[model samples]
Target: MNEEVENAFLPMTSVSSGKGSLVIHDVYCYTNQIVNICFINIPNNKWVLIDAGMPKSAEKIIQGAEKQFGKGSWPEAIILTHGHFDHIGSVEALAELWNIPVYAHQLEFPYLTGEQDYPPGDPSVDGGLVSEMSPLFPNHSIDITEKLNPLPADGTVPLLSDWKWIHTPGHTPGHISLFREKDQTLIAGDAFVTVDQESLYKVMTQKKEINGPPAYFTMDWDEAKVSVQTLRDLQPELAITGHGVPMSGNELTRELNKLAENFDTLARPDSKT
Candidate 1:
């Protein structure tokens, strides 16, 4: 593991809510500004991980899980909202170690099964250093064909019945978000991010700002705009995005609305490659 990553994921303070059965674990990665990996703890020792974070953060992820569920308790399965390198860096390693199955949208199969490489990040298209440095982001596919399963035909994700998977692509061809209708908790992948991920300073400080997906990897600007609007219509009460701290209540709702209304202006690509 990289020294920076080792320090970044050092065991974080854990919090549990007595009112509800849900538990959320946040894991941070030190590269490309700040990357957050979230794990939702449900019943029966089963947990749902939203994204995989940067490479080698798996050890820390497992450690976080153990902190909540006790040592040696691995998730029944791992569900990915997308297949971006940061989100999938440690997927194969973690899945192999735990001998667990992995789930993703069928549209994301090309990347996960080593069938296709996502288009390279467009650094010149955005001004932020993260975008300028995006050429460094990995675009190679992972060969996890055997352990992968597609979302159920009914659109309900396994182990998460109350939640529905929303195909919020554009950040990547098959990126997705998870939504629980009952209480409206959204786990937005990269369709839209709650932080200006390209700004290293803002990331390190944990500043709150809702913005488009990480500019480095976002391919289709128009599609991305529509996706953000679609998610806003859901009016999620709480959102845990791929980056930034999880947000909730009227504040999130207000930001989402503003994003949807001005998507073309705010989410448009800075330049065409």
Candidate 2:
């Protein structure tokens, strides 16, 4: 690992099984809110990055990849569950460096291609400081039209055969999650997060809680609940979310189930339409 980049985010954490068949690396980005950029390493030194964290995180992401697969190796493709600013922060830079395509859901085309702007984050919707400060989050679009490829309508993500991408919008118009049927490993983007992102203290400490996306950025509470329930039904054995450490076993399953069962109680916005 690049000591400099790894140390940039102190108390950096990662989880891997000794079986060694599949590995997930967490590249933590400490920014407006802490974000977790997960990279999955498969056999033959090949890998796929789930999301780009904050701006200027490309180097750290590359560093983490190299630590596992040797230097100068690039993923076959960069898959984005959404085009939210934090998630796509270093996408353009990384794609330029690797000369590889960036894949996103078809519904996300507007944001990725600079065709439309996402609704402004609703700071008034919640009381937390992060929610109250949401007005500062970027709502503008990123110009990466040339580098983006539409995900397959069949839901299979390219280069990752064992996994399927599920549409889980609400945090953004086109948010998504990845699931491996064989092992039930899920890479849930912001459809739901594993942290109480609105609290600076929880974020800094990497506290684990299964919650919805940052309240400020989440537009529709009802849809968000449905999205979470859809994911819970998959009964994933392991999950790596966008904002918390990877979770697994009965604990992860129980939390997901609770989130699904009481999504409205836990994640719905107070200001209902």
Candidate 3:
């Protein structure tokens, strides 16, 4: 008799890879691989999905949603923070699977419709293997024209009455963050993540910190700095960033303030000695 076996290494998942938590009673945050996706509940069994995870993660996201909202659960729509590969990775799949519309800032329409592609990432700007590996990530546009819709100019998030979408560009021309004025809870996209995303070790360990957008992918340092300042002005009591675990209260305040005050040192790659 003869037997054969296969050998392989575990997945690239982080410590919090498959974990989730409730930032509030109705707002749920789940990590899909390295990126975080939000499920915001609305009354009458309705909910919205904010940003999709890494590519080919549609199945995982759907399963998580089913487990979150129970069987047969589907979001009213998908809200894109930007057209970057990581955030919208599973978007096309999820939208097609559920036949739902996808909303994005008009500036992002070109990228989503395959009209334009983002510039290749700048690996020379940051420290980490992830940064060095940036050249491999796709900077090309994705086609999702039929399912795409422009976000409202008034800032109101469709289907979410109390929440507003704030334009937070720099990570991308149309990057945006969602905010709930009442609780001061913010769903900040890559405008600023809660982890040093360009650092492979930090990303893998899920280390928490208030860092600017991934250095390799950020196109405009000046714009990114202003975006962070704008968010800091909001004084959010809680923030669910695109990456890393959710941060709230004083920890969030202190970290955000420090990040804003020292962005040149803390975030700007060119400032490093």
Which candidate leads the pack in TM-score?
3
For candidate 3, give the lDDT of residue 171: 86
Q: What C-alpha lDDT do the candidate models reach, one value each?
A: 0.72, 0.73, 0.86
- The runs of at least 3 residues in candidate 1 whose Cα sits more than 4 Å from the true structure, single-residue gaps closed, are 1-33
The runs of at least 3 residues in candidate 3 whose Cα sits more than 4 Å from the true structure, single-residue gaps closed, are: 1-11, 271-273
| TM-scores, each model vs. reference | 0.86, 0.87, 0.94
How big is the positional error of residue 150 in model 2, measured in Å on the Cα after superposition?
A: 0.4
At residue 224, candidate 3 shows an lDDT of: 89
- CA deviation > 4 Å runs, candidate 2: 1-33
Candidate 3 residue pairs that clash: none
Of the pair 1 and 2, which is ahead by lDDT? 2
The residue-by-residue lDDT of candidate 2 on 1-273, one tens digit each, is: 122222332222223111112333422222223666666656676777777766666777677666657889888888998877778877888988998899998888888777787786677766776676666666667777888899999999888877899999888878889998888888888888887877766766767889887788886777788889899999988887877666788998899999899777788766754
| lDDT at position 263, candidate 3 | 87
lDDT of 3 by residue, 85-181 (tens): 7788788888998999999999999888888888876778865778778777777788889999999999999999999999998889999999999
Instruction: Measure candidate 1: CA RMSD.
Output: 5.5
